[model samples]
Target: MKYYKLGIVALSSSLVLGGIAPIAYAETSIPTNVLAAKTTTSEVMDKERLIERVHELFPGMFEDVREEEFRFDSGRSYGEESELESYGLRFFKELSSDMYVSGRFSFVGENLELVYYSYNNENNEEALFPPQVSKEDAEKIAVSFLNRMTNGSDYQLADNDDELYFYDNQTLTEPVEYNFRFDKVVNDVPVPDQSIRIEVLGSGVVSYYFNELTGKQEVFEKKESLLTESEALDRLKEASNVELQYQIQYERSDDVKAVLTYLPSPKIDGIHGMTGQYYIAGELLDKLPKKEKLKVLSSTPVEKTASITKKEAKEMAEQLLMPKNDFVKLNIEGVNERENYRGQRVYDVEFMYETRNGGSGSSIEIDVDTGELIDYRGGFDERFLGEEDSSRPLAYKNALNKAVDYVEKYASSYVHEVAYPNESDNRQNRYDSDDEEYRFYFPRVKDGTIVNGNGIRVSIAGDGELLGFSIDFDQISDWPSLSEVVSKEEALKDYKDVLQTELQYVSNNNQNEYQANHYKLIYTGEMDKEVLRKYYDAQTGEWTAASSRYDSGKQPSDVTIEHPWAEEELNFMIQAGIIEVENPETFNPDAVITKGDALKVLSKSLSRYYRYERYDYEEQKRQTFKNIDTDHDLYGMIELAIDRGVLEADTENFPLDETITREELAVWYGRILKLTNVADHYEIYKLNMKDSEQVEKANVGYVALVGALEIMTPNEDGYYLPDEEVTLAQLALSNMRLAQEMAEMDIDYR
Candidate 1:
């Protein structure tokens, strides 16, 4: 067995048998001979106290340990070096040759506090199956352990959908663990940045824990001087504006439609209730500057065809991304063709910077057909230059101009389709001050309306050099008519009617440094409420929720609770997102299911590709049946079934809407089990049942296999009703049984 080092820490001292070595310390706390003489007694006592704390947390697990030296620079300077005793410390112990436990602690004033802890028992055989504790019990253990922390009383359990310990599709061989997040609140107002995350294993052990709580003091806005809720809403309404745009409805179909939406303005994030001013990145602004539109870079159209060779594309990349320093050269690694997110074929050129360390590299993507620069991100890090210069950085306006110039030089053929950037597009607060890079987004325009899903993003470094560029344009031919849409006023009114707000303490500029940052009390929409998060559909004059695989409150109806047989299986399928419930109140499980609906559920439950989004460009255009075109609702699922050999396109047009029979289901199950050859030879199998003659001769082997495997059983009277129509409930129960048998047989359909 090979032992692995877990973190990026320097090895300074040898492994100690009983306890940590006296000289073992973090790099930031390294002491010279003179400094050691002055602080030896105090430092030794602090180290002993921290070691005792670790032993108390994980008793008897870390006796034989080694110290790893790491640097923790908070970017704050103390007056003198002798004033600060230590900064951070890390220690690990080998439980076995291949398993270990580690803990990281930081010095807070006079005491050492644990910042992170982990137990590397992920591959242990004992943790793989048959979880000893339930998720509810594990959650209780987590909460009990959290209450012993220093700031435990200030935190509350976070309400999110990520708290599930196991998913329906998860295999039984995978380890079971519960994850919980607790958010720190100030005077009952939740702070988004300060939180603690804890992971509890199946054995009810706290396996990992990390906290983002800071030590620095902070100032918060006074709530006593705030305005009323109605007053804040009025200010938000005054600042909000509606715009007409083209939104691609990918969930329904690949169709672009004109929509009048009231999207939250990028200039304003929230309203400050204290002063009735707009909050833009935590700064109060009396009013926003006038919005400006970007002018088209070119007026001429370019041909969309393969005009350049592979060698020419490589040459273009070298010409555009060549470094300024002669010693550092751009080495072309290789080139490959792949489909981008928008289903466009492009050539990805990967290259590396031949620097001293020999690891930093980036890639550039170009359109193979039009030979346009689709994506490129190249810049020189300060460390790569072997020296640092104290030169001043370029102004924001100068950097913007440099970015525009680079785009025009490399992507002029496609630049005419995108609108140019304005002043508000500058993302100054999103990056660090030392490595600040300005990003600008230019939206694509269609018939004078912006395309929400299509845009071009450009990033320029502080030294006026191109850092990154990418274009996201889809080939859409049909667009809805804009003349018949509702007015912008009506759309805005509809949004305001459903909008609701709650007060919370938010960090300035959305920074994660909670202790050193300032916060303000603001009224904003509750993100957890789905009804308040929808947009008004201008064409239909109705509100439509965001596209998701499953909607909130879309569980099986109350009628399922009284189900005599398939209550659990029906609820499981619905919760797993395999079966969509159109009407949660009236989900009649007894209704007969069509061939298309049955195939959809089976394909999604067995194949991982059908459940998730596929970016394979070739599969996007392929069709298996004549009736199930690319535009059909069940095209992808049907194709997945055909590919998996569960169904075949033996006929030109499949009867998608026809009701399925019991014999048909058995045939599908037999194919899934890879017994097709045996099932095809029906003459070799004999059926012994009351209605044995009712089974077709061609389906005798299929029915025999399903009955023997217990995937689908006969009726109470031992009568095989092969010609009866299968109901939704009957399919649900049988599919689950088939899945269990597949797992037992070690057959991985996914």
Candidate 2:
């Protein structure tokens, strides 16, 4: 996030060398009229006008404060030139006890549109800190702050909101910060990605505030939903699935343990407004077009399977730095051989250097089969930046020349092809340095199309020395010679054909706890991991597959069960198909539930469709539990529970068939609540029973949770009867209650 690139001259020149070309269509597919309407600019505001607007916004906050205006780097670009303009301001105030606070703000134009603002206390002394404020007080402060920024506009508070986080210490000595987020509403519905956040400290002081609003609000098209909420939910549910998977419990050991459970399917945040259907979001890619594949090559190799020895890799790495005289004595740090992500065997070689001046070394990857360079990177010794005899900073052109020479000398035997630099990746560093740092990124192209992940990035310091360099060549042996078969117009048509605009209840996660549905265009094309989808591929006239869908578990066929008391509960579970009985015709409600059966139900209830990595348990069974072996029907679930710390019975004597005690069941359910992050709200209720003392102290949390939820009730004697065995019917009812609670609370199990 360094602001190094400033000069338009250098930025434009580098873009030309980077091989970027103008495209006919908008990359994001946003209509040209929409784009134009959003870019409307106003006349520039003077410093006096900006100051007046600030004073009007806040009546007394700016009194006697030192204020200044300076150029700010607005990180944005349009066409071939930089479109960033700065109208920034800074204000500083010294408090009563000599502790100082500072505030920074940015304005867009004559109307004084505030884009960014932040305030922080400079002193760390505890005595000077302000008094701790309640959550309500913080909300009031946030409202005042937002009201002033928006010039009398108002916002709403989200439910289960007012997040409070403590830093430094949990004790009274540390300060707690409360974050308040508000959204701008249009036609009684919240706008997407347009909101303001006001963070208040314990002192009720506004610490940070940002209004992420852009585009002309007046031009926004507002509409109503064409589909109901139930329809959208159904679509997502049909396409999505919850899976069970084992992850190492990071809170404890690094050793393999299948303790944690997670869902593989991505959940929908809300439905889109325009497209009244369920849609995923791209928070990652935004609306960029998805490339089919990245073309990566290291020239035409002499052989398809040429072997590269460790010694050869070391030598090739050293050659990349030959042109630079800074590296004096170099030693091979380490060399490792492994298959890369593309299934190509490669050698990773690291080299450290004793510089003649003050530079560092290189880490390079070489393709083992073709003896070609995959990537090379090295860091510069920063001490050289301050030295009097350090090399003079090179001009932008000279730096590009050096970078090209380095790549040509060490990368490949074929002519180096330069792909255009990605607009998002292009930036100039401008902080903590004497000169501007220019960065250039170029994809290695073959057969016209730039490969997806194959590229070279070179950064040149103001001193003309290489700041850093990197190259990614996947060693693609063959590439399609001709461009995509489909025409650009055809691809555009395809994109529109598959695009879906849905009425979704979008929550910016700031305001509107009761999310209102908004119409938004959703790409119906293939999505990757989340909601963001890939754009239609011009060559194929089809949207690229974001990723292949996974198969969750399937349910068993319907069966009749006759246990009257547990009939409803059993049927519900059977419909969910997470837990199944061997004999579907009868569910023995009065049967004593064994530890193995209980755990199997719990594990499957949480994550039924999840695939688990099976391990040989012959040794574990012989050394610990004899009742459950590797061949046991419920071995996977029981073992998973044991590894996850849900059950911690004596390993040597696992009573798989023995009826589980009520106390033990409480401990198991308690562990589940903790693992699933269902808050333990157990302190409010008091148990008034003589047998309460019989409940083990370790199982108290579990008992309290179940009791509070009425999942477990006392007997006529008002006794919990902690050690008594529970029947299958009772456990099923409790499990059902807990499942319902999880859904209602919206607790994330994955």
Candidate 3:
């Protein structure tokens, strides 16, 4: 969270979908008093007034559209000093039964200023009506919408440099939707968070979304800098300490061919702007190797040949841990051949220490065809960690020697020109902060350029024993000629002229606020990351592909539930801070849950409290509800639920005070699951439950999904028992299952 001055920009914000972090501004300084005054919520316009405003803006688009109102209980903002009022307008047109197109909007003022807008051509229309328009045609439709809304001025397509992204792999038979984005331009500079995103479905129906932009369009004078571009580039190069790597490029359509190119290593994101001072390093750590780029080799099938024997594999593994004295007895666990991802066979030999100088397990893999050690992992025991005993500690130089000996013995064919101790990998002890382990990385290089993703990682414990080690080499055989490469002087000239600097409003999560500052420029060039583009020719530069946008890491607080319906939802809600898991290890999904817990989950999941504001610890203490007071853990959520109309406002019949029935659960689920009400087709689908007739018509869809989709189940008698109370675990699991089903079914709630 520490903000860098003139260093690597981690860009704390999450990537949207493709792990591509778009350029965004945190905040620009405005007077504190003015910000405080503007933070208050204003009264929402009446439904008629809002509809009139929409009609006024579009003139004809809303003539046949139906409008509805939604109120948010608690307002929320992304950054400091920004909060939205709880009112919004939704417009829709029913194309047929179980099919429709709709748009949602939120306004800014009494004038009904348009702060947001979105449209969706729901119902999988691509199967019935394929898209007649191309990506270019969709762009025109998006532009037309923007022009009509803004009266056609001061806006243009921001991403004209790259072709519009069309996800053809999404479906094979139906036409895929094309999404186009347009950024607002004022005084010839792109406005930070102001843009329009339009989605065009196969039916040629466009769904539009407008990002809420609050500040006035003010032009500031571009200031002259004391530092030159070359100076800034030098500072950037030093800050990033980018290493030159030999990238093995591949192309496969009919035959698989490999071509190695020399260039700088890849990075997480591009450098946005350059500062004058030398920035601190390690804001971003090690660069991951690029993928082989040949997922499916249709014509070139890999041959699995078994030439090396089990004995040879064991001998090579023992050589890796050689020069062992009589006291150090090693035991060979096993040696077996296995098929890799590419359908190639290799020998996997495992071993362990059987002596007093304790260690854990270790493994080594030798290519069955080539008889070369391709991979290795050396492990250590937990006893190696803790304490700062000088008597047992190994010297840094000796540890490095042991690491080098192991690598050279097995991977002697590859050159190792790069070696650095990674300080970031050090695990500090609670008793002694100075006591730390050391991790060293040795990257292979050829013809002066380092090889990407082909290297060895060695770790030395605090007690000086080799903690762990790994060697990875993804089939990098063909090397490219470096004779045609441009000299460093020539590349530096283009780097100096093209590298631009800009004043940006930046914020690191370290501070709760943002400030206007200058930074090194970052962007994705025609080929690679903006940071590595200057290392060589644009076409030949070694670029890393973007990482996954979503973080799939597990959390410690997650409750383990066995039910397929509840596990994912329980984990998601716990991670989102929506549902509390009293016990971290287990969630009692089958046990009957109380009404207070149910309401808290519903309030968090279905209400604005989940989207905008979080549970305010201090604010909950001031709760004054007669039945549910400050002592209750769900005090804040219950209050918001009542305010937002998710629950009844009657204090006498507090939802938190009673146990919830199955029918009541259905009603609450129905409320959040659908944006607009559809006819209850309870009698249309066949009912398997014995007492299905007892289910109310209104709650049929909810109950059906819970039962049919296996989100919830009936008793041994095959009766739904609509009035039966549900457990907290059951509620979470059922909702999570429903969400998954909706996503798979392509249901559009927005």
Q: Which candidate is the best by TM-score?
A: 1
Worst 10 residues of 3 by lDDT: 8-17
lDDT of 1 by residue, 354-437 (tens): 865665787889888878788887755655565665666677678767777876766676667777765654443233444567
All candidates: CA RMSD in angstroms? Answer: 10.7, 19.5, 24.3
* Top lDDT hit: 1
lDDT of each: 0.63, 0.50, 0.48
lDDT of 3 by residue, 436-472 (tens): 4555666555554555545566655555555455555
TM-score of 1: 0.73
TM-score of 2: 0.36
lDDT of 2 by residue, 1-750 (tens): 011221222232233223422212111121121122122222443556666766776568676664453222122222222233335555555553334566666555446566566665533222112335767888988888777778776456543222322111121122356777787665555543566777777666676777764332233344544445456444443444322222221111111111212222243434443454444442322232232333333444422345678888877766654444443566778989876544457898877777655446667778787676666555444445444435556665666666666555444443346544433332321111333456666665655544433467766666555555655444333343333255534533443343333332243232221333233433232233222323333334444422111222332235656676777666555544544666754657677788767766666566433332234443233323567665555666566666656766566767777789887887676565442132232343345556888876545556765565555767787888988888877787777656544432322232
TM-score of each: 0.73, 0.36, 0.36
Best-to-worst ranking by TM-score: 1, 2, 3
Higher-TM-score candidate among 1 and 2? 1
